[model samples]
Target: MLKEVYGNECSSRTQVYKWFKLFKEERETTEEDPHPGPPSTSKKEENIEEISKLIREDRRLSIRGLAEKTGIDKECVRQILHESFNMRKVCAEMMPKLLTPEQKESRMKICVDIPNNIDIS
Candidate 1:
């Protein structure tokens, strides 16, 4: 009946059966139950601040080193660095993934200088 009414827009028969069973059982909401696990705070403001401070103090610090120093999980440290701080590893050192205005200007100057400083004649 669902396939006839909704055609391809209808969900699979198994899913429809599951929902039907739930509805018949008087389930109030269709939402899935909350997942069971310890809550995560690795990306909390305090942790971000600590991670940022550590990175600023030693931009060469490896993710493993930061994890050890801060006692945070390595994966969490990596997420905080990449997602929150917008940084990445470059030549074994932590560096901003994107260039700042000053860095951009400096890079432009270097690129411009190569042509002017060289003898094209």
Candidate 2:
């Protein structure tokens, strides 16, 4: 249609047809990009692994410092550590419970028999 309207002033018919074909193909293909939704802002696995390694080497490093070194956002660094790595700093206390006399006697007998190479104890 453009060729009919523009006549010989359109330069080349072959190039125009090729461009129309390409435009039609692109209109269909832009829907199926692998990422699908909005583009991700974070680095890929190898880069995330590097960032995790750096964090492991120094847990005290601030998120800002990590961002400066890794070229990722501070919030991203924190997210990667907290969400991806499941890291946290918490103190846990475990107390030993008192065992019953029978339990203590059985445990001691088993320990003594094991050291003596007795299987039936």
Candidate 3:
């Protein structure tokens, strides 16, 4: 009946059946149960600080190297560098989050200068 009414908008029959069973059992909410395990600690403040310090010390440190030094997974280190720090690797080195206006002007000048400075002879 729900499938008929909702058509393709409805969830799978199995999921609908599960919800129906829960409703029959007087379940008030459809929220999921809390996971039964230790929570992740990799994204903690201390870890972020440590990762930041490590990266500051050596901007060229590879993700694998950071992971090995900090005893954290490579993926976690990468997340901290990218998401938390808003950094990206360029030329195998981590660059600042945003370039200064002067730096942008310098880069533009260099780009324009390249064509004029070139001697095709």
Model 1 C-alpha lDDT versus the unseen true structure: 0.80
Measured over all alpha carbons after superposition, the RMSD of each candidate to the real structure, in angstroms, is 14.1, 19.9, 13.0
TM-score of each: 0.56, 0.42, 0.56
Model 2: per-residue Cα lDDT over 1-121, one tens digit each = 7458545544366555555665766643244332223234564687589777886677666667778998776777767767676664333211124567987899799988886895665
lDDT of 1 at 36: 26
Candidate 3 regions with alpha-carbon error over 4 angstroms: 1-38, 105-121
Better of 1 and 3 by lDDT: 1
Per-residue alpha-carbon lDDT of model 3 for 1-121, expressed as tens digits? 8568646755666666666776678765434733222245577789899989998898899889989998777898888899988998888888767999998999899999999999999
What local lDDT score does residue 70 receive in model 3, on the 0 to 100 scale? Answer: 86
Top candidate (lDDT): 1
For residues 1-121, what per-residue lDDT tens digits would candidate 1 score against the true structure? 8578546755676665665676688775434733222235567789899999998899889999999998788999999999997888988889888898999999799999998899876
**Model 3 TM:** 0.56
Return the candidate ranking by lDDT, descending: 1, 3, 2
Ranking by TM-score: 3, 1, 2
Off by over 4 Å in 2: 1-35, 89-121
